[model samples]
Target: MKGILCTLLLLLWMITGCSNNSASNMENNKKLAEAVKQETEMPLEMPTDFNFMVSFGYGDVTKNVIDTYEGTVTKDLIIKGSATAEILFTADELRDIYDKMKTIDIMGPKELSKKGNCFQTPSNEDLWKVTVGGETKTFSWTDQKCGITEDANQLRELRNYIQHMVEGLEAYKTLPEAEGGYD
Candidate 1:
């Protein structure tokens, strides 16, 4: 009887341990699935008609120009938009532009020089700016006829696109050399 009782207790303990491990694995799998889903849901391409303008001012001369640029939100990073200008700069140029624009240095009104991620004028005009190399550019609604609120949705989308691009670039930089391989 004693032998039988001891064997039965041991079996029960083993079964409970197995069950606990199974539960833990299931929980881990669930978390992993959620992470994967979130990553996969990120759009791989930027939405159509993602247009923004960049205006530059030097002393008394201020030039406002418009560029129809496209963007992509890849699993690795987000690309807001690229200019159609003939001047082609490498990836480094793009990164420099991104870094400069992420802050509100030359975008804000002349009165308020405070730095920010995005800038807004007193007239409720919102502008996004970026600097490449030493040149600073500002982007705002060119029409000047339509209010910023009119394109609020589009601006919001652009903001999200920028965020994703920044995150992707950061992730790519941290990846191991073996994973990226020689390109």
Candidate 2:
């Protein structure tokens, strides 16, 4: 009877020890996961002097431009109705732009395609100039509907994104309606 009780007590002790070890292991695993998440999810270090300029519409004569360095938006009509508005972007907004630029590898290449042709007469144009980390890249392309290069299409998307963002801002909304229409 004593032998049986001793064996049962040893088994119980072993089981308890194993459960404690399992709980410790689980805690360690959780800590490791949290540490990895903290390391990976850390916010990116934004550049100190970042500037972006996007001029879009029917060439330069009938275009609207949002220039961060100039802190101005120039809204142009075909010939006569041109207006300039003061604008400012908050730090958070700039950070968001930086994040988006990084996502699209804007600083990596001037053009993603080597051989692509686009053609349109008096076609709308999108000109993007971005400066990051003291390096500048300028991209110019025509309307996507005119069958532009792949890189130009990417720029179009970027331009559209910025235009949409600007349109939602109070400054853009306050601007007077464009006076004339392009023929």
In order, how many clashes per candidate? 5, 0
Which residue pairs come into collision in candidate 1?
Answer: 76-168, 77-168, 78-164, 78-165, 101-130
User: Candidate 2 residues 6-32, lDDT tens each?
Assistant: 999999999999999999999999999
The models' CA-based lDDT, in order, is: 0.40, 0.75
Provide TM-scores for the models.
Answer: 0.26, 0.66
lDDT of 1 by residue, 12-53 (tens): 999999999999999999999777655433223322222334
Q: Which segments of model 1 are wrong by more than 4 Å?
A: 43-183
Candidate 2 collision pairs: none
lDDT value, residue 123 of candidate 2: 66
Write down the RMSD of all candidates, one decimal each.
19.9, 13.1
Least accurate 10 contiguous residues by lDDT in model 2: 107-116
Cα misplacement distance, residue 74 of candidate 2 (Å): 1.1
